[model samples]
Target: MSATRRQILSGAGASVAGIAFTGALSELFAGSASAASGVRAPGDRPPRGGYGPLVPDPRGLLDLPAGFRYKVLSRQGDPLRSGEGPVPSNHDGMGAFPGHRGRVHLVRNHENKTTGKLGVPTVPGLTYDPAAKGGCTVLELDGRNHVLGERVAVAGTAVNCAGGPTPWNTWLTCEETEDKAGTNGYAKDHGFVFEVDGADPRRTGAVPLTALGRFQHEAVAVDPRSGIVYETEDAFDRPFGLFYRFLPRKPLGGTGSLRAGGALEAMRVPGVPDLSAVRETGTRFEGVEWVPVPDPLAAETPIRFQDFGPKGITHAQKLEGCYWGGRAVYFVSSFARTGDGSAATHFGQVWKYEPHRRRLTLVVVFGPSTDIRLPGESPDNICLAPTGGLMVSEDGGGAQHVFGVSERGEVYPVARGRQNIGTPEEPEWGEFAGVTFSPDRSTMYVNCYTPGTTFAVTGPWHR
Candidate 1:
């Protein structure tokens, strides 16, 4: 559903104001008991209906495609180094760091915009914060799930949500907060993208892509060739949400650091004034297109794209997860609500934006269908599977389930029983968040934030 001012206001009570976010950081913690929330009792595991035999459900561990299985690469409180503390709560976005001896450097975003649960310091130069919630956590891990090292307190901000991997192997962590520096001290730099080195988590730097402007940031996508970074926001109120692109000032001579700033531009629908009217209308298979990034650095300039009014803006609502795959960029809306903030017939949707042709395709409208029984449930984070399918984490209810759908539109269950992570009251669990696959496509990782837990899933899937 489109998060209204009422929603934001309701959460305002939890919003932490100035007080040096770092100071909020405190003792390190470990994953809560009960494995993962929303998970089913052991024996009821769905058989390998599509992928393979009915292997034992990982339970608290990562769930994967039927034929596939996984192992726990890391847990919430696991020590990355000898004396380092556990990772923080609310792990979000991450990316793979490249090198001959490549490893996955995960820059996890904490959705905790208020509470402070930062970890302990292992070395002399470590920065310890008792109030480091809502920032990003850096963890280095090998494919075998071996912990190489970790760095907490990366960017001292809150609600840092879904970010993307840049061409340079850096993870761009986006803050979902609106620009309210007047109150949220970090809001000035909070709504912009912060770059963190994937190789070294200890090395934390906060540089707002001023060119990227400020808004309720969601996710970021990069075009390796042009060095242009595309971004999505969760704004559902004013003028609707926008799709943006950051035109860097300089190209990396050899995949340099994100320290090289660039121009940020918001996208608007061409010829459409208010996209609010066309929220959920089904697609006509018409060729989709987006308006140009006018100011290139201004957040206000309109960058429009074609949408449906009969159904309301399909891309409307609190836009969340995003990924760059198959020569195109894909994004999903958290929920489709009316201007009055009422739930649409469907809970969520997935859309595709072809950068080369500058077009959009409303690929899927999720609801109560023959296959997916969950209607009015919102689909959260998504990742592309090597087997040419899309992996989605369902955040609708506390009992979360993961699913896979091939390019041909065939959908099936990959993993089940991921619920129970969050208590009914806390809001944020339900087994759907941070769904990703290993580079080799042999492993899968899932994280449920409310009562934080990380699962490593492995199985057989021909990528």
Candidate 2:
């Protein structure tokens, strides 16, 4: 459930105003929906809950409501005009932007880590590591399923994780692996953030923004008003993961260039220690402070174990998706329950950070799940619907569905995904990721990581 208005800001669970945050679109939607019907295609199961409960997909690919429809825009093994062999698998985070005329530009992440597939190998001189199999692909599309063009936006990165959309209109693609230089073959360090131009993919040379520090970066959110960048770590080993903020020496410049010479710092709560240990759903921590990382590069040590660890920055479990909304940086922690090795009680927690107040508060959270058909367990990628509150892409086991959490703490289903049979003996059930809407808000786009597929959805989104 949601916290009181005051609780969302202050650490106290009190309500000051009955209001909805700018980023949460729950207010515009209805609480419960009349179960809808579906027509199953060959080898597909009946539909479950979604926008209108879900209608079975006749194509056996995706399920939607009565009026809604979906089209597979891009798929794995699809030939690209760009030299990047074929569309890579393990598609993760993504962002969409306005392009020429009525076209929209999309920069999608391919999270594959092995060198088996042809990663982002299209660019001539821009290849970072020819042997690495993780990078991003750029696509230009129109209102329908037509893919105007596609190409490699960047390459040579490992575990290219979820990044944020810069105010300067570039996608900051972060590498999730932490392989040292020359260790995993012959190449430079792995974990770094690279900026790719969405307006024109070919122009972006896949330059790494080293000033943001290197670690297991899960996601990033840039505060538009302050030009400060907030990052999340997905570390699982010793020293756990910590939240970070990178202050550019100079404010954000043109072309999405993250200026070097900036200081990276970890987040901490003054007196309320251990933000992760909080057991309640709306637990809040006010007056959050920033501790310098001293060596953000982490060449000698990971970001969590650095001096910043002893300084009292709160440690979290697998911090994932991050985004800017309602004057706060909304972030996600997959699971932190007692079973998750954390003292916390929730299976997942969503946090909100106020840049002006330098405060961090827990916003949305979920307990363990029993049914696989519902929005099970882990909540990964995040999206802000102007009229639908917060839509979360569930990365949980069993049924992979996109669930919505309202500002008032109410949770509901947005969509559900069905497994597409490809290779036998392998679980084709993929996470619904890289969720974003068209600039016009008429179409919604999402991806299934394996049996790699990208779908464009459109209908009465107001529901």
Highest TM-score, which number? Answer: 2
Clashing pairs in 2: 1-409, 2-409, 24-389, 25-388, 25-389, 26-389, 38-56, 129-156
Q: Identify the runs in model 2 with alpha carbons over 4 angstroms from their true place.
A: 1-50, 271-273, 337-340, 368-376, 406-410, 421-428
Residue 94, model 2: Cα distance from true site in angstroms: 0.6
Instruction: Give residue 147's lDDT in candidate 2 (0 to 100).
Output: 91
TM-score of 1: 0.73
lDDT (10s digit) by residue, model 1, range 1-463: 2243113212212221111111101100000011112232443222233453233444644334344555555556666454545666666665555434656665566666644554323233322222334666665677676767766635456577788777666777787765444454332424566676656544534545556656678888777667777778787464457666667788553334444666555444454433333444344234444334444333443233323333233235667887665456667676655644533434566666666776665555565332223312476777666454456666653334566654434445566543345455774434556776555445566666655555667655552
The candidate scoring highest on lDDT is 2
Q: List lDDT for all candidates, in order.
A: 0.53, 0.69
